[model samples]
Target: MTLRIGVIGTGAIGRDHIRRITNDLTGGEIVAVTDVNAESAKNVVSELHLNAKIYENGHDVIKADDVDAIIVTSWGPTHEEFVLASIAAGKPVFCEKPLATTAEGCKRIVDAEVAHGKQLVQVGFMRRFDKSYRQLKKIFDEGKVGEALVVHCAHRNPTAPGFSGDMAITDSFVHEIDVLRWLLDDDYVSCQVILPRNTRFAENGLQDPHMILLETKKGIRIDTEVFVNCKYGYDIQCQIVGETGIANLPEPQSVLMRSEAKLSTEIYVDWKDRFIDSYDVELQEWIDSTVKGEMNGPSAWDGYVVAVTSDACVEAKHSGGIVAIELPERPAFYDQGNNKVL
Candidate 1:
């Protein structure tokens, strides 16, 4: 049975999802769409030649009879309401990260989902579906790297136009916030942010080259360097220091070119290029699981925890002090033990 999907926010990510659902994947079709920019939505519908109706707003798309499920790719601030509406309508929704712009907003979504008595929301944390990350996770789980001690991560971007002071933590580093928790199967206890010098390329009062220090409940230390004006290429690196051995993410698989007295491999320009396959895998899995009346990826609780942790990190960034992450007890509704190894 083809799941009829309604998509909100026909921006870059939203349009990409519509393309994936309509052209790249199976068991799903986008039947309705709405965006704050109606022209963009119309253009996407026409450009893709999609047979979908343009609704007046996101709520109308959610209420459309033909839309069996919902996908929220709108602005981060608008997520809580659309997701809650989907839950109230008893439809599964795939929400892009932040879940909401704030921790309290995320908690509201969690409360609504719990009151509905089932899991109907999945957050788009696609790194978990990356093949390389999965391989690293498997190695860690198998004790190939016996008892991870510390993790060093780097998230680099070629250029960041709108990145401002706290966005280095809230917007860019948030991915690490979620994936690290999944990798260690542990929750964060405290966070601290360290700022080095800023790059001349940074604009709009954005701080570049920030370091985030996180401590897990299990006493593992993780440090991430978020450099938005790296100026070279988009690079993501993670190295796990363990008791017995060290494991790291393999460099992006590109053909090595030896010419002009240089050895080189291509670097992706953005997340869209770097993790396209991971996004495809994540969406395909979501489709398959939703068809089976379940969800098999990051839950709403995961989104909430990341939001809470991110809030702490933002506070740490501003205050120049270590901030403690205070997370509520995990609810029984989420099946915590179902995390798959590899």
Candidate 2:
């Protein structure tokens, strides 16, 4: 059965998902869409040659009977409302990162889902579906890593035009927050942010390169360097050091060139190019599981935990000290054993 989908938000990521669902994926069809920018949304409908109707607002699209499930890719601050509406409508929703902008908002969605008595939300954290990351996780699970100890990570971007202020932590580093927790299968105990000298290319007073330190409950240490204006290329690296061995994320395959006494390979310029396959796999899994009345990726609870951790990181970034992360007990309703990390 093809699931009729309603997509909210027609921004870059949203439009990309529509293209994936319509062209690259199966078992789903985008029948309706809405975005804050009406003109842009209309243009997308025409540009993509989609036979979807444009709703005046997101709520209208959710209420439409033609939409079986909803996908929320709207602004971060508006996620909570649309997700809650989908729940109230008794439809499964796939929400992009950040279940909400605040921990309290996330908790509300959690409470509503728990009250409704089912799993109806999937948060988008595509790294869990990346093949390289999955391989590293499998090695750790198979005891090849032998009790993981430390992880060194780097997230670099070629350029960020409007990135500034706390967005460095909230917008970009948040992915690491979620993926690292899943990688270690442990919750964070405390977080600290170290801001080094700013890059001259940074705009709007944004801190160019920042280091985040996270300590898991089991004493696993993880450090991530976020460089938004590195001016090189989009690169993500992670190396895990364990007791007896180590594992690292494999680089993207590229044709090696040797010329003029130099050997070089191409690096991705944007995240969409870097993690495109992961996004496809993530969405496919979400659709397949939702059809079976199940959710297979990061849950609303994971989203909430990440939000709490992000808040701590932001606090640490501002105060120049360590901030402790306090999370609530995991409820039985969301428990699915060892698969929780995925």
Candidate 3:
């Protein structure tokens, strides 16, 4: 059965998802879409030649009978509303990041989904689906490494033009907050943020480089440096230090070039080029799993956990002290990772 998907938000990421569902993937169809900028949404429909309806607002698309599932890619602030509505309507929703702006908000969504008595929401934590990360996890599972001792991670961008305040923590560093927990299969017990010298390239006094220290329940340490204005290229690095061996995330497949005098590997400048395949696999799995009435990806509980973790990180960023992360024990509802208990 084809999953008729209604996409909310026609921004760059939203537009890409629409294109992918309609043109690239099977088991899904873009039947409806809406955006804040109706003109831009219309332009996307025209350019893609999508056979989809342009609703006046996102809620209309969510309540449409033709849409079997909903995809929320709008501004972060509005995620809670649409996600809860989709839950109330008993439709599966695949939401992009943050899940909600606050931990309390994400908790609300979690309660609603739990009361609904089914898995109806999947948060967009794409790194868990990336091939390299998958391989890294397999190494851990297969005991190639004795035990993970420390994880070193770096998320770099060529430059961030409009970033300010704790956006780096909330917007940029949140991925690490989510994926690291999944990678380790442990919850963060404490967080501390170290603010280094601001990069000269930072716009409007934004803290360009932040060192976030996280300690898991199992005593494994994960340190991440989020440097957005590196002015070189988008680079994502992760290395697991284990008792016996080490595993590093393989960089994107780039040609080894022996240039004028040095051998170099290409680094992508745009994020889209970096994890495009992950996005494809993530959404395709979402489509396939949703069709079987199962949500096997990141759950709403994971979103709430990440929100709580990011909240603690931001608190550490402001207080310059180690902050405790207090998360409610995982309800049995989420005990099943890739399967529903019911």
Candidate 4:
């Protein structure tokens, strides 16, 4: 049975998701889509020839009884409402990162999920589905890397997302908070943020770069470098150092040949180019698992952890020092590393 999907937003990533579902993946079809820009939404629907119904707003799309699952790719501020509405309708929802703008808002979603007595929300942290990252996790589990000790992560964007300095932590590097926590299977205990010397390449108002130091509950440490306007490439790389070995993501394309001294393979300048396959795999798995009454991605607990840690990191950034992160005790429901009840 094809899972009926309703997509909200129809912006860059939103429209890409529609294409992925309608053109690339099976077991799912986009039935309806909504965007504040009706012109763009209609153009997207027509271009895809999905015969998808267009709505004036996201709520109309999600509220349609025919939508089995709703994808909340709308503006970040609007995530909480659409997610809760999907829950009220008893339909599964996949919301993008920064689940809510604030910790309390995320907690409300968590409360709703718990009240519903089942998992109905999956947060979009696509790094968890990337093949290279998955390989690193397997290596850690296999003990080839011995006891996992530290993880170094970098998220560099070729350009800023037309936002202010504050959003650098909330909207941009939030993926690091989500995926790193998922990889280590532990909650963050504290976060320390630092601003490096500014880079001139960034637009004057932007911060250009920052650093986040995170310590997990089980004592795993992560140092993250976030440079929004790197003037280099869009890169997401991590190196996990264990007692025995070190595993890191290979630079996406390593085949460098020098012909005219301008050696280059390809530097992904955007998320679409860098994580294209991961995005496809991520959405495909979600559709497949939802069809089977299962989930194959980050849960509400994961979202909560990321939100709490992000909140702490933001505080640390503002206070100019380390801030303690207080995460709720792990529930038994999330103890499994491979999606099984412990």
Candidate 5:
């Protein structure tokens, strides 16, 4: 049976998901879509020439009985509402990162799913699907990287979005928080944000860069380098250091074919270049899982942990001090191989 998919928010990622479902690869078909920018939504529907229905709002799309699953790429604040509505409608939903803008918001979505007594929401943290990151995990799990000691994660973008600092913590670094927790299979106990010397490359009044230090429940430490304006390239890197060995994601190596006098490979200037395949793999899994009545990606628990940690990061950034991240005790529900962090 082909799963009927509904996509909300016709922005870049939203349109990309629609394209993925309609053209590239799919276990489902996009049956409906919505966006606050109705003009863009109409444009997408017309551009794709897909007969999918267009709705004025996400609520209408999710409530439509035909929607078997939902892909939520809307603004961060609206995620909680649509996700909870989908849960109420008993439809599986794939929400982009930060599940919600606040920890309280995330909790509401989590509680809704818990009340439903099943997993119905999958949060987007695409790093888990990246081949290089998965290879690093495999090597770490093989004990090639002995007793994991520390992990250094970096997320740098070539430019900053025209949003607030809250966005920096929520929409952006939230991915770092979630993926790090998943990689180490540990919960964060606290977080501290350190502001570096301001970079002239950033826009006026923009924070430009910061460092997030996180400590896990099991004492594994993680340092995340977050810079929105590196003036170099779009980059994501992680190095896992263990008592016995070290493993890290190698940069994209290319065959340097002789051309003009310049010996060069390729540098991704944007995320659409660097993580496009990862996004595709992530969405494909989501579609396949929706068809099978199962999910393998990050769970609501993962989203909750990230929300809790990101909240703490925001506080740390505001208070100019380290803040404790209090997480509920780990539930046995995630203890299965699905979350076996090395």
Candidate 6:
């Protein structure tokens, strides 16, 4: 049975998901789509040669009877509204990051879904679907690495054009906040941000590289370096230090060439290219699970926790001190997500 999907955004990420579902994956079809710019939605249909109904507003897509499940890839601020509407309509929804602009907004969606008495929302944190991370998770779960003590991570990019302010911590670091919690199966207890020397490449003297220190409840220390102006390439690195041994995230497949007595491997310039396959796998899994009447991905609870974590990070970034992450105890309904960090 093909699940008729409605996409709430026709922007880059939304368009990619539509192409993936229509071309790469199975058990799903793009039936309805809408964006803030109506013409953009029409262009997506025309450009992709999709036979989908274009709507004026996202709510209309959720209201359509043919749309069995909804994908909320619209602007971050509009996520909560469309997700809540999908839940009220008794349809499953796949929401992209931020979940909402604020942690309170994310909690509202969590409360609404809990009230609906079903798991109907899945967040778009694609790192969990990466094969390298999956392998590391399995090794950790099987006790191959003993107990994790310290972790070093790096999130780098060649350049960020319009990025400024605390977006390095708020916008880009949110992905690390969600995925690391899942990788270790632990919740963050505190967070602190260190603004290192600024890079001249940053727009308007923005803080280019920020070092984030996170302490888990179990006293595991994790330091993540967020460098948006590395002037090299998009690079993501995670290495776990354990009692017995250490493990690192495997690098992407690339060819090695020896030229003039020099050897080098290609580095990805765009972030999407680094994890394109993971995104495809993530959405395909979401589609298949939704078809089975299941929501086996990042839950609304995870989204709320990420928002809370992100807020704490932002606070620490400004205060130049550690901020405790005071999160509510996980409700029983969403414990399924915590069990395996799906």
Find the number of clashing residue pairs for candidate 3.
Answer: 0
Task: Residues 1-342, candidate 6: write the lDDT tens digits.
Answer: 999999999888999999999999988999999999888899999998998999989999999988899999998889999999999999999999978989999999999999999999999999999998898889887888899999999999899877778788767899899989999989999999998888878996688799999999989999999999899999999999999999898899899999989899999999789989999999999998999898888889999999999999999988999999999878888866433543
| Cα-based TM-score, every candidate | 0.98, 0.98, 0.97, 0.94, 0.94, 0.97
Worst 10-residue lDDT window for candidate 4 reads: 333-342
In candidate 4, stretches whose alpha carbon ends up further than 4 angstroms from where it belongs are 261-263, 333-342
Model 5 over residues 1-342: C-alpha lDDT tens digits?
888989999999899878877888857888899999999999999998877999989999999988899999988779999999999999999999868877788888878887887788888889899888788878877889787788898888888757455666676788778777667666777889898897887775767688889888788888888888887888888999999988898786557766798777767778876777888999898888778888778887788878888878888988998899887765655554265443
Deviation (Å) of 208 in candidate 1? 0.8
Worst 10-residue lDDT window, candidate 1: 333-342
Judging by TM-score, tell me the better candidate of 2 and 4: 2
Instruction: Quantify all predictions' global Cα lDDT against the true fold.
Output: 0.90, 0.91, 0.90, 0.83, 0.83, 0.91
lDDT for model 4, on a 0 to 1 scale?
0.83
lDDT of 1 by residue, 21-55 (tens): 88889999999999999999999999999999999
Clashes of each: 0, 0, 0, 0, 0, 0
Report the lDDT of model 4 for residue 31.
90
lDDT by residue for model 2 (1-342), tens = 888999999998999999999999989999999998999789889999999999999999999998999999998999999999999999999999889999999999999999999889899999999998998889888989799899999999999877768887788888999888898888899999999998899989888799999999999999999999999999999999999998998998889999889899999999999999999999998888888778778999999998999999999998999999998898887886234852
Tell me the tens digit of each residue's lDDT in model 4 across 310-332: 88888898899889998666566
Q: Candidate 3 vs candidate 4: which has greater TM-score?
A: 3
Between candidates 3 and 6, which one is better according to lDDT?
Answer: 6
Model 5: colliding residue pairs: none
Candidate 3 runs further than 4 Å off: 339-342
TM-score between model 1 and native: 0.98
